[model samples]
Target: MEREKVIEVRDLVKKFGAFTANDHLSFDVYRGEIFGFLGANGAGKTTAIRILCGLSRPTSGRVMVAGIDASRRPEEIKKRIGYMSQRFSLYEDLTVRENIELYGGIYGMRMKELIHRREAMLQRLSFTSYGDTLIRSLPLGLRQKLSFATAVFHDPEIVFLDEPTSGVDPVTRRQFWEMIYETASQGITVFVTTHYMDEAEYCDRITIMNEGKIVALDTPSVLRQQYGTATVEELFVKITRPQRTMV
Candidate 1:
């Protein structure tokens, strides 16, 4: 049986003036899998995600997300993806329920469906008790969970999480990954970028980017075997250190 490709990129490029942020990148993310995007800062992970999410235009090359051509039909693609950025975008002053409602409305979900899904999300996160609490009042971990729940309120086919666990505590990070696993189990493709090496191991497969291009892509175990390293961190160091030596 052939799995459907939820995301497809070919020769994708993103340039800013004299700098190229993404240089002819290409990859495919299968449906219902967690695809990890790994790279050091300025490695173009976010740039590639932005283009795929229809948040930015690629400078050149073919890009398809959720079966829609990004360059020619970004608006259509936007409806199929949920994006959670590094910065939690929920309105701090709004209550938890309010924030969820706001995003549901933006996605044009019916009030009835929004209400039902909101309750289910709260139950899943064990956050029903905090439904009326202001988002600012919740602890950071809970807020992060809420932000993720809000992003997928519309049941998007794929979710883009750009450093969603950055600055979160170890316990909270574990909890967040639990949510991610649950989401993937429900058949939502999770495309996430993270700097944490251990978290990279959690992905079904990972792609390592260097200098705006994909330098490595494979299962975490395969990557470790190929690099003769015990961990993703070591592999990252091995791949990136040579680049540093040149400078």
Candidate 2:
């Protein structure tokens, strides 16, 4: 059986005045796969993700997210997708449980359902003991986990995580990826953007962006083979290097 495509983008373009943030980008994210969006800072990864999340409009091209045209029915698409931004978008003053409740309420989850999910999530993260701790007081790793859990509190079909593991220690980053795997195992499609080349290897497939254009798209192993490099970092350097000639 063939896998279903959860996200479809065709010649997607996004421009801000004279600047093009996403230039004719196109890609597909299959259901139940971890799709990594890799790029350096200012490579347009965030711009592209924003367009797909229906948070911003594209200048041209077509985008269908979760079977709905993003430009035409963004609200419908919003209901089916969860987004965790790079900034750890949680209220610092609020307790972990309160933050979860806030996001659940926004998703329109019933009170009883929210309570059940809240318990499960806290248990899964071993955060039940700190349920009442203010988000600002928690360590960075715990705060990141809480942000991720809050984003998917209502169990959306697709989740977009933008640089979710930035600033985390290596051990914590590994733990975070394990949680991502757990989420994928539950049949949720994960669309993530990160600057960590090693993490790209964990993705089922990855798309690398350079100067607002997609320069490489393939599985990590295939990308390594194609670039004749041992790692994604080496591959990325090769792919992004500009041609030079002796004068």
Candidate 2 residue 29 C-alpha distance from true site, Å: 0.7
Overall lDDT per candidate, in order of appearance: 0.93, 0.92
Which tens-of-lDDT digit does each residue in 1-247 have in candidate 2?
A: 8889999999999999999999999999999999999988999999999999999988999999999998899999999999999887799999999999998999898999998999998998999999999999999998988888887778889999999999999999999999899999999999999988999999999999999999999999999998788998888877777453111
- Can you write out model 1's per-residue Cα lDDT over 162-231, one digit (the tens) per residue? 9999989999999999989999999999999999999999999999999999999999999999988899
User: Highest lDDT among the candidates is held by which one?
Assistant: 1
> Candidate 1 regions off by >4 Å?
243-247
The C-alpha TM-scores of every prediction are 0.96, 0.97
- Clash tally, candidates in order: 0, 0
Q: Which stretches of candidate 2 lie over 4 Å from their true place?
A: 242-247
Query: What is residue 88's positional error in candidate 1, in angstroms?
Result: 1.4
Positional deviation of 210 in candidate 2, in angstroms?
0.7
> RMSD of each candidate?
1.8, 1.8
